[model samples]
Target: MKKVLIPKRKLPWGSDHEAIIWLMAVLLVVGMVNVFSSTFITAENENSAPYAYLLKHLISMGIGFVLFAMSWRVDYHKWRDWLGPVALSIAALLLFVLAAGTVVNGAKRWIYLGAFSFQPAEFAKICSVMIAAYILSYRVEHKLPINILNAQYAFIAFLFVAVEMEPDMGTACVILGIPIVMLWMAGLKTYKLQRLALVGLAAVVGMCIYQPYRLERIKVMFNPWSDAQGMGYQTVQSVTAIGSGGFWGMGLGQGLAKYAYLPEAHTDFAFAVFCQENGFVLVALVLLLYGAFAYYAVRIARDAYDVYGQLLAGGIMLLVVGQAVVNISMVAGCFPVVGVPLPFISYGGTSLMMTMFSVGVLINIGRYSRAKQAKEKLDELRRNNLKNHEAALAAMPGRRRLQRIK
Candidate 1:
């Protein structure tokens, strides 16, 4: 057998998990290029600086990265202890937004804070995950029934309803998706998981059944080009830009769709801008990057040192990848457009910052994963040595003689 060495471990802003760190870096760069392309036309039309959106996105990314570093350095265990108050705080913020949110494009999802406005729904998604994971991990550990109607799951349901009331059905789905995925992966039995799924399905259906905007979106998903310039206009434009990419894309920054043709080019439909500029080949590459990131993120979750890390990291993996899938599908017209931003690639400051913060949490969990195997081995060695020493003492002639005398 080979000897093992345990070195002092440190988290220095960058993760020990290089795959996640580099993948995020590449995606942020891609976001900058595509965000500029997507927003330049909108800025120019508004008579703002052509790079204004790009600059704002940069500042947002900067702030997000700082919080990312902070989260990475902090211990993941603190979240478990803080879960309840954090959940209540997030709930308060959500209510505050609902009560005071500024409307944009007919959606009441953001609150104005002086010169800046933000969507609390974005941060609420992460908060929901932390809360759900904390509760579910405990349930799994204690062999409690992971029931859907339970208050733990009800908190998630409450969040979903709050976001849906904001009419941001896209984000509402994600807030729900992350927890459901986490619950299933945390080893909730099939029958109970099924119940949770059914309840979730009912909630989703009920939320959508009465909304006119949602109904219109569903109709557009099937034949987006039918309306050409009305209800289907966004889908039509997105598909047009993607189809125009041909074999090698229109070349970076050369796409025509972002010239005020695609309304949400820098946000929900960012992938379309990327497809328009980078072509099918590079578009596939971007998807592959997301794929690889998801794979490694899951690897981190599987190898984590504890249940909390597993649930926390796994839910985040679902949150980022799930949101990406929704945005891509929406752009491709396979699903109706809702306001889900491509993780790490969208133009929204709050969205980008919160996402980075979550990624930081994932990275923190991964750091323990990297050192876990070696640490476990060392622990096993110490246990075996201690047991052997105790046995030898018990068997010693003097110890036996003393026990007999007593």
Candidate 2:
């Protein structure tokens, strides 16, 4: 049998956290630049300044960076205890949004705060992960039997209902998807898992039947050409934008489809805009970056110091990276057009900030794991030295005899 060789590359700043940051950095830079190129046209016509959208994105990025720094250094353990209150707070916000949220594109998802707006569901993703990690790890740690339908899952169900009511079907999927993945990773029993899957399937069917818009998306996905001007408009335009990019792209800020031709040039279909401006060459590079992020995120989760940390990091990775996969798939027409946003690349205030904070939490767990490994090595060495000293003392003279005599 041959052993596998996994190379360890040191991160900058001499940290043994085994953290990966460069890919995220690339995504942010590319996201900001592409977002600017994709929206400068609309911004120019909507406002006098062509850079207005870019300036707003920069402000959002600045806020996200601040959150990232704080979460990256904080201990991951604290979130375990604070999961309940945090989740409740998010649920309250969700309800408030339903009650008095600012509607956009016929959906009441964003809650306005004076001049700016933010999405509570964005933060709810993290809260959902935290609750799962906390409950699962707590059960294992305390030797409690797994109750599949405990208050923990009930809260998540409530959140799902709230988000779905917001008519943000895409975000609703993510809300439940995070928990299902976490629960599976946390080792749910096969029978219980099957039962949950059935329930989830039933829910999906109900949602699709209830929302004619969702059904329309499915129809458009299979053949956008049928209604290219109706429900298929966004999908047809999205694919068209990607196809127009060709091999080398039209160059930055040179894309014409974004000029009132394709909807959401900087949001759900931002990847399409990215391709339209940078072509397949940068697309390949961007995909590689996204892959690297997923790989390192899983590695960080695997290297966590404890069960709680492992579940925590794993859940965060699922939420962040999983959302990216969903969004990209929707844009490529591989999946139904759901409004899930790319993690760091999507032009938004809350999603980017929440994603950066997730990465920060992952990095913090990695740092803790490194320190734990060092401590374990030191303890092993001390034990070995003690054992050797005892052996030598015993062989030196009548150590056993002395003990017997005493």
Q: List the residue pairs that clash in candidate 2.
A: none
What is candidate 1's TM-score against the reference?
A: 0.88
Candidate 1, residues 94-180: lDDT per residue as tens digits? Answer: 888788878888878888889787788887798888887788878888988775557877888888889888888888888887888
Q: Which residues of candidate 1, in runs, are more than 4 Å off?
A: 1-16, 381-406
Whole-structure CA lDDT of model 1: 0.85
Judged by TM-score, which candidate is best? 2
Cα lDDT listed for each candidate: 0.85, 0.85
lDDT of 2 by residue, 1-406 (tens): 9999987755553442333566778789999998888888888888658888889999999998899899888888887767777888899999999999999989899988788889999988888888888888888788777656788888888888999998888888887788787877877778888898898889888998998778888878999989999989988899999999999998998987889999888988899998888999999999887877778778878878888888988888888778888888888888998878987787888998998888888889988898889999999999999999999877766867688679
Alpha carbon lDDT of residue 238, candidate 2? 91
TM-score of each: 0.88, 0.92
* Residue 33 shift from truth in candidate 1, angstroms: 1.0
Candidate no. 2 TM-score? 0.92
